[model samples]
Target chain A: DDEVITHAHGAGGGQMTELVDAVAVSQFADAAADVGLAALDDGSVQPIDDDHSVVVTTDSHVVTPLFFRGGDIGRLAVSGTVNDLAMMGATEPLALTSSLIIEAGTPQTTVERVTESMREACEEAGATVTTGDTKVMGSGEMDTLAINTTGVAVVPKGGHVPDAGLSVGDRLIVSGTVGDHGISLLSEREGFDFGGDLESDVQPVNDLVRAAMDAGEVTAMKDPTRGGLATVLNEMASKADVGIDVEERSVPVSGPVSSAGEVLGIEPFDVACEGVVVMGVASEDAADVLDALRDNPKGEDAAIVGEVVDDHTGQVVLDTGFGRRYLSPPEGEQLPRIC
Target chain B: DDEVITHAHGAGGGQMTELVDAVAVSQFADAAADVGLAALDDGSVQPIDDDHSVVVTTDSHVVTPLFFRGGDIGRLAVSGTVNDLAMMGATEPLALTSSLIIEAGTPQTTVERVTESMREACEEAGATVTTGDTKVMGSGEMDTLAINTTGVAVVPKGGHVPDAGLSVGDRLIVSGTVGDHGISLLSEREGFDFGGDLESDVQPVNDLVRAAMDAGEVTAMKDPTRGGLATVLNEMASKADVGIDVEERSVPVSGPVSSAGEVLGIEPFDVACEGVVVMGVASEDAADVLDALRDNPKGEDAAIVGEVVDDHTGQVVLDTGFGRRYLSPPEGEQLPRIC
Candidate 1:
């Protein structure tokens, strides 16, 4: 048929751009589209409606095994999707669907488990898995379970969404502890013995998001999936074109997760969070949002981690407990294995 | 960690069902969600407002070599999504997300092409790829290009769904020539030399569907995907529990596709169709709908090949050109292969 995908297309950056523009767009050109190929194509098209701004983001999870330490492909699939919807101000995601690429030899069990996870997640999110499809490949063409899910959630009538929500003196809040999901997965991958209990922090945060929203006019929300808390906040700051000042000591991190992080020589800030949420809100609403978040079962560990200031331009600076500052966007490309 | 997925999981249907019902659900379970999980852990608890209903559907495209003769994984991904949405009475698909299981050694170019294809498709359908995820499997865990896509299409207000309006005198109408997509794919799959200008019927049917909707009071609409033409009509008949009679000669078939089918020992009716649609309507509106369909680019080959009768319960009797009658539904299982 046409050319198949090259490995670098999965790299999450520049080369990915070329592949989309050259082959993907050319082969699937749509005559009815205002721009034959839209933003994801050669030319960018502005959002149709300006008043109701749309939130956009993309993420990929390449955990070594399709199944994981505490969960399998299905759970991971749903968690990744619900987390994306929550990051935006949308509520009650109405629908979601997933496409599957199965290895020729993949067990039927894996496919069902993943769909089951999606169904369960949809039911939880008040959405439906109204449409779906399955396809198989020759052996070695795909991982046993690789799923891609995209969906939508309705923004409430009074909801306001914009990247510039952050400003001087605004507050930064975290729904709960971070790095647990990443740590748990890493431990399982590295075969670290957990004395008592360790689990991935993967969970949907709609409840916590809704709670946080009720607590205050949230400036922005994000699920730190790939580059973790630091990167997410950095992206938000860059897009909002604001500076972020944070107290690393105040950012909640579980003892086990922190210990695991130290041993692995990886910062918890870049660790993946299955359910954790990073929130930006008005300084006045910080305490209230934390309270509301803690009240929710999923956000019992929620806390006010830091504040947003106008000092540094789009950079996130961490104030260590000893009154020292550490620059933390990530020194280089985080290895793919950790997430 | 936990085993992602292995060969045992993809076994027979019974095992597949159990796997779907168990682990996958638990993984995506939300806090309030019942056992099943999405991100929140507790279910996504939101009540409905009572005015609208959401339409849900899922599709998976696993083409050979992750690309094809006239298209590639990217084109198939988008077309697959759009077509599934049209199968329902939805007007424009609102969003699309894909879950990918990419093999580690696969080139990144391939992944980008597929994602770009997804992005383009969303634009054409007036939908957004608001969220998506990618997971890479260890080397040898999968074939290079398996992709699963799930989408949501908002069904317009008014009971625009198939209510089995199927009456004693309703006519069965097919939107266009069949077996093109199937035969083309089959030819490519096997090393058979096929001739003629045969293109896969993988175009989206939003325009064609709109034409049909505007044409008349429709009884039903079904897209022949996995099961193909014969099984689709049979399903409509079985659901209505009414007898469906199809005029064999009147059913349209592309000459080359038919020729290829004969040579390959494939039943044209059972082969997959990427763009064709099967519609049932009141006998009176049949002509108008057929006319409207023929006017669209996708429906130039539309045909009215059958009608509903009072007997046969759930059986579909096909009128062979030579006066022989054949019962078709398929013996035990569908193609088990979704690619």
Candidate 2:
């Protein structure tokens, strides 16, 4: 490992994995959790009783610019944790804790805007901000603001989904278009206007996921946030010790996002999508799940983009109609503070 | 409100109270919690079942220098949340989530040291760091590091304590000496040689609190952190709509801390004490609680500081033998980034 931390170490890539394992997992090896630090899943699960278990996840949002076209840091802070809980099959969060660290000179209006955004997002997700802490740092000691939210949800014991539960014949379903968030933020930050259509798809997707789960069995689930579709597929394949075969053309990408990615020399599939979920559904119920997801407005572009396979275990193969190649996890962050 | 946030808005005093009430409490007005954002207590409680309730609390640590005398940011981060849960009568935390945001150029060794300290603190508190998130900001965009920790504990329904549960005849007891943490850090930062005895009292006091709870009936509880003992006393008095009368000489102040505070022109009651707890116990149980606290090494300096009164509602009076005065909440941050 390098002597000093770098941007890549927090980019949700191979480097970040190594860093987390070495620094956190190794130190917290004795955590008495069913799916704890060692699992590196969307959240940790602790059985509270014979019939119920508690699910928890935390994320610190340090997104630059604070506000973008579609959402602000406050919305991102709440949705990020909510989606993580939803990934573990805990769709309805019991509560969310918000801790804000603001720079000394940040405008009071900015704080109000962020709080209002968080409230609206909580309303949208059917969750509440129950408790929070606030602190302000010296002017140059911190950036504009950073919001850390921790979400708690309870599910029936043995009922929560895991990212490594995929079977050989499972089908992979994507909730919506890929790479909209990362691409949109990149375009906006670089002063490249791809018109109003190129805006972040940063909204809570727990309701969309609830619909999908209600329709059929979701064998494995994950949201493509920091590392996008390619990274998530690779993670699922490797974790389950199975192979994934994806039809590249089946993956939906908005026209504006596709154009913007090309102009920025970035791959839509290699970026992030805040309001998206990639799930491995049982083969028998794939069609019903797809239909259920498509019925929701947030998942109107839902598609069956891939399938779990036995051959080429621990790898993700992308079929582009003319050829096939193994997709890899992203190496480093493409756009810093795009969350 | 000022156009921009200043240091006073986060000093855990009058200004900070106004900011939190205006921004967070107003936005999260609909939180369906037993003790939610509106109460502004140490944590929030949600009933999980007929016999059990869930307690949750969060704190974001942005201390300067990262490493202080007796503790670093790591110990403070874990202990802060753990103690908050303990103050709510949830002595045994099931799990804690850590979210670290570091500057791009910080040394990995610094992170490892902090993680190690956190592990030790968790062990002392009988808790676990079950899940976490890490992110890096651009160099110069942030200080060395900031840690946000959220704790979750389950207790019997209606068993938790609130800061507003004080009664007219209740007795107030402090677990240890005051002004150690804040004064130590101030001296260290200003390059004053205060000697090793003046170091921070920053260890987790959950065990000590547990002993007291087992020995007596505690009506109200609070940890003196940012705005210190005076702030906690005032908050308790105002929230419970009662008065508090304190014998100034009875409040324990170690020789070193007393001397340092005198030289620095700061009142011990107005500064932070990370490892101390001020509890309002039934008058009959005051002696037993004090004895139980004194049995623990961390609480060896325990003393009966005050008692609740019916007169002067929502105010705290200090009896100095020669004269009497009202103890006011610290006006602004005495020191920035002191955690």
Q: Pick the candidate with the highest DockQ.
A: 2
What are the clash counts of all predictions, listed in order? 89, 0
For model 1, give the RMSD to the true fold: 6.1
For the predicted complex of model 2, DockQ is: 0.77
Top candidate when judged by TM-score against the true structure: 2
Q: Candidate 1 chain B — worst ten consecutive residues by lDDT sum? A: B39-48
Off by over 4 Å in 2: none
TM-score of chain B of 1: 0.82
Predicted candidate 1 versus true structure: per-residue lDDT over B219-323, tens digit per residue: 777777655787677767776789888888889998888888898887788867878888888888999999999998779999999989998877788888777
Task: Please give, for every candidate in the order listed, the TM-score of chain B alone compared with the true chain B.
Answer: 0.82, 0.98
Error of 1 at A33 (Å): 15
TM-score of chain A of 2: 0.98
Model 2, span A3-57: residue lDDT tens? 8888998889998898898779999875566788888999999998899899999
State the weakest 10-residue window (summed lDDT) of model 2 chain B.
Answer: B28-37
Stretch of 10 with least lDDT, candidate 2 chain A: A29-38
The all-Cα superposition gives candidate 2 an RMSD in Å to the true structure of 1.0
